[model samples]
Target chain A: AQSVTQPDIHITVSEGASLELRCNYSYGATPYLFWYVQSPGQGLQLLLKYFSGDTLVQGIKGFEAEFKRSQSSFNLRKPSVHWSDAAEYFCAVGAVAGYALNFGKGTSLLVTP
Target chain B: NAGVTQTPKFRVLKTGQSMTLLCAQDMNHEYMYWYRQDPGMGLRLIHYSVGEGTTAKGEVPDGYNVSRLKKQNFLLGLESAAPSQTSVYFCATAEQGRNQPQHFGDGTRLSIL
Candidate 1:
């Protein structure tokens, strides 16, 4: 069985400040990792995905995440956040041959002016 | 292009009431899933379909039934609504293969009183 853990439940950051959300997963093999963002009253949108290749993957909205195998972590980072970036973010992991995904509890981000 | 679309964006049902949530996708994907989102809990899979006429239980598959009569449609039914079932429901679809990303719908906010 696979599971995901997001250490942060809520985070507040000022506009133009850097932000990082922690995510950890427990999987047996190389896992397919993904980051999704959800705005208020909207569906989730794919931020980025890491299947294989570069350790660091860039996503839409200037967000990026690095896959650290040794630490079993895939944290999402943004150099600077905007006021419109206030949303909930989730990290998910899928098996190489599986048909479903396991998602973390999610981190709610607040961008203040 | 409209991706995954879930019908009845919002619904309020009473206890013991039965209703069905419809999920339709135009991506021609091979896999579809139903999930529920609650406060402080990430999305938990309720049921999923690998293809037409095939359904399988997921992480949290209680008090719910699912059917996939067409490859583009997946229906989630609640035989008896309960307060615990009041949450946002999401539908997602993905192509058949490893490392594929799942696209999500805007979600349906179902409140059971």
Candidate 2:
């Protein structure tokens, strides 16, 4: 079984401020990780993914995440967030056994200007 | 190109009713997935297909049925809708490998009374 945990349910950040969302995953095998973003009433969009690569991976919309195997974490970060960056973000874990993504409860980001 | 398209963007159904949600992908993907999103629940996989004619249960598949008769289409059916099933449903497709990112549709908001 694979699972992802996002400790922050909701977070508010001032515009232009740095932001970091924590994600922890548990899987028995080597895991493939993903970060997805979703706007209200819309489906999820891929923010980034990590399979077998460098620990630090950059994604679109000025987002990045670092995979820390020792900590079992993949936390998403942004140097600066814009008003439009407010959305629901999810972290997922997958492996070759089933190839199914198990997503976390998500973190709601609110950017305050 | 429409990355992924789900039919009936919104629907309301009474308890015990049945309906099928259609998902089609233009990207010639080898994998397709169905997921439900609820507040504080993030996204839970309902069912998934690795290829045409193959369907498997995911994290949550008790109330859902899925079929993949064609490579480009996956259908999720709710045989007996319940209030617990009222949530937004999303369909996604991925390339042939485990590391490939999954592209998603706009989602279908299904409300069951």
The Cα local distance difference test for each model comes to: 0.93, 0.92
Pairs of colliding residues, candidate 2 = none
Best by lDDT: 1
List, residue by residue over B1-113, the lDDT tens digit for candidate 1.
Answer: 89999999999999999999999999999899999999999999999888899999998899999999999999999999999999999999999876888999999999999
Q: Give the per-residue lDDT of model 2 (tens digit) for B2-61.
A: 889999999999999999999999999999999898889988888899999999988789
Worst 10 residues of 2 chain B by lDDT: B94-103
**Residue range A1-113, candidate 2, lDDT tens digits:** 78999999999999999999999999876789999999887888889999886999999999999999899999999999999999999999875644778889999999999
TM-score of chain B of 2: 0.98
**What is candidate 1's TM-score against the reference?**
0.97
Residue pairs with backbone atoms closer than 3 Å in model 1 (clashes): none
Docking class of 1: medium
Give me the displacement of residue B30 in model 2, in angstroms.
Answer: 1.3
Interface residue Cα RMSD of candidate 2 after superposition? 1.3
Q: Report the C-alpha lDDT of model 1 over A64-96, residue by residue, as the tens digit.
A: 999999999999999999999999999999854
- Cα error, candidate 1, residue A21 (Å): 0.8
